[model samples]
Target: MVFELSQSASDALWLETHQQFMPVTSADGLETISKIPPQLGKGYEREVALQPGVELHIFDSTYQDIAIHIPENQHPVQFMVYVSGVADSGDFIYQDANWGYVGGSGIQTPVRTFFPGAQHQVGVIVHVQPHLLAQLFGNSESKLQPTLDVLVPGDEQPQQVFSSPTTGAIRAVVRQIIDCPFSGVTKRLYLQGKVFELMALQLEGISTPVCQNRMLKPETMARVQQAAAILRSHLETPPCQTTLAQRVGVSDRTLRRGFKQLFGTTVLGYLTEQRLALAERLLRDTDLSVTEVVHCCGYSNPGHFAAAFKRRFGITPRQCALGVISAQS
Candidate 1:
């Protein structure tokens, strides 16, 4: 399939292409599910309005090659997470396990191509109103980072695009959203919570310092990456900083400096982030109890685990498991 259309006109095009395909809409009209025409592919696409200003698009299908051209025009802020398949969008490439952000105005026309095959193209796209985004990020007196500044643009701001590999935390949330089991109003409420969770994660990921390890020697960068791997592999009982440095064939000082330069955080910071992320996945996806999750993720005290979990995710471990959204969240 090949077509050129404004991003806003995409659904109309889909309807035109599959005249026989009837969309199934919820009673409240907040959710619509459409199946791909058998002649075109297998699987389905879902559109859900999580709220008045936030919309979610979930696509999961194996289709023949498809190309879409989006012309220069204003666009609402979008956060996209691709789980599989390759989509080349001009300067930005979207592939398995990656995320991308698009916002601002006057974007150049980009021809996004989806390769042909049996592979499933699974992904979630969240469209947020500009004003809602601004409110979410807050109106700080201080200047926003360049990457984020472009997302909450004024009338004259230029176009912006950003992409990065999805972090474990982000992948976990995406899995939760894709696997959401509820239906009807219950499903809508569940999705609304997950959407906010995803938005928070994406914002946190983008607000971090951009990697600036280009100045580091190749060998040094390699060692730093090795240290990160060691941390991930030993989340339950990670080595001390000095020991981790030695394991990666680097001095303690070098390890610390490398982590800050390459990852924008210290070794311990990275470890804690990874641990909590793991705990979050466990709490949401597994039958593990809060206490078990605490120990599994290396927290000796359940109280401490709950505190840290709530601090990092805006909801306690138990609440996360129960799909309860706190006011703070």
Candidate 2:
């Protein structure tokens, strides 16, 4: 029998499962004695550990159609590996955002993270810090999009896709992070190196190598990225762009232009988009009501929220929550 989970309550469930699997800290070293119990009809499972500074979560399939709400415009640059059963049906849709197709099919040569927004079901996700990835790439300024709706399946590169050898190397680093036994600052350092190697690979494929000898410009870019990060870090109560600019040491004009150029949206626009994306994900993935979702996304007026949502997505939040949104290709 197939099971379904309520969108509203599943977050608590996710948190509960996360806490249960986390390792207990001791004077000796970081030891993970906890193990996830196998569920009924469980085909495969593994207990993985992330480098200490990074946190990891393994979600069960109680909710077959799981939706994650990433309220920030940027997500941790993550590398994912599928270690088990095939995800027969699912696509990471990039609805208000942009995404591209990455390669992955059953029996494929275990490709590294080459495909942009590659679609899959069963896989491991690695969340690497952007600064770390940038340093590794020698770019000094880098930001990866956080919210990917659903991934398209195809060998052909889709619109807004970012594919390069560097991304693949990041995938390799994820593999190493999963398989290696390094810890402490050493682990972070090695991971940084692996990430750099990944970026280098990406550079190999790019027709225009702008990153070459571009260390001087990264300082300004890094500040722009830092401002965006501040917005994301406070997603619950995200501040205005003016405040964010002051904190990040960039002019409001610079912040606005930089985010638009890099992320395809203005800073405030990106924040709103993030909130709406989070609301949409919760609507589908959780059991939250429209009113509850309103509060969750930081909107006080449900009617205003509904109108804005419809304008951006062509359907009311209610319609989406009812699973009536048309499937995109």
Candidate 3:
């Protein structure tokens, strides 16, 4: 089946189809298949539907940069994730005109003069659901302010592009999705979870000072701060690096480096800390059960939340809330 794009809510767009590339020389040969309006350009933030029971989207658009033209837009901010590949817009995001890796090999750095076009084949993209977006940034009725942009590689101690070790973990998850595209309801839920995780990965770094500080470079500091602000604005659902990068004109690698050096952790890791911290506060201040706390903390998995809570506070969520587990003897 072919993927189709449908209007979702006021600001967000939804794709309910699974699509994959058919060989250019295959039986049905077409030079270019324009799914979105042509005037908007070929890369007009569009979603795709691959084979049967598999619907996915890879957003590669500058629509956010031109969103002002769309009428009655209720969405706050627009961003996309650089899931499992490399992207480089010469003189666009990176100052020196460099190419950066999103979920590719090596340190996700940006490149320019020589971009390894589509180095990897497997990639995944998911549009931010409108309801989720509204829930995250409900305060503002109009457009929300811009946050984090694309991140690129930087010159630091570890000499890496990303801020923390969790960057690698995020990449691993992206790669897994590439290897195994989900199907049916599973794919829908999987995409939702993956998109959420991607946002969390981006925010994870911002929640911590060290990682956030890494984003304090001369040319790239603004983008980093913007990204952080965006994440901070939406505690429920945050935009991914690609969308963030495209809107503000920066490479995901740059954001990663700055976030790492400044905050001392990966973006996703920092986001987790924030959520867990909030959960902890609720556990202490309120009488919510661990399950309720898990949902309140933006986690759907109680077991996972419990384990993470224990790891963070040296006590399970229940013990922490009930004062059963204490540091003092």
Report the candidate with higher TM-score, 2 versus 3.
2
User: Model 1 misses residue 184 by how many Å?
Assistant: 3.9
Please state the error at residue 156 of candidate 1 in Å: 4.5
Tell me the deviation in Å of residue 300 in model 3. 2.0
- Per-residue alpha-carbon lDDT of candidate 1 for residues 161-246, written as tens digits (9 for 90 to 100): 44444788888888899898888788888888888888777665544433233355534654665677567656888889988888
Best by TM-score: 1
Against the true structure, candidate 3 reaches a TM-score of 0.34
lDDT against the true structure, each candidate: 0.69, 0.46, 0.44
lDDT of 3 by residue, 1-329 (tens): 21222223212321211123221221222112223333222242324343332234443432211111222222222223344333333222311111112210113233222223323322344334334433543333322212122221222211112222235656666565544465566664665566556545544433344343433543355456446545544445667767767765678887777667655577777667767866876788678887887877677778888887777878877777876654631
Q: Return the candidate ranking by TM-score, descending.
A: 1, 2, 3
Note the clash tally of each candidate: 0, 20, 60
Q: Candidates sorted by lDDT, descending order?
A: 1, 2, 3
Q: How far in Å is the alpha carbon of 327 misplaced in model 2?
A: 4.4
Local accuracy of candidate 2 as per-residue lDDT tens digits, 1-329: 33333333445654565576664442334323333222212222333344533433322222233333322132344443333222221122121112111221112211111111222223344344534433343332332211121111223322122222224444455466445457665654665555444334433333122233233133345455456545644556887878888886788887877676546688878888878877887788679899999988888898889987887778889899998773431
Return the TM-score for candidate 1, rounded to 2 decimals.
Answer: 0.57
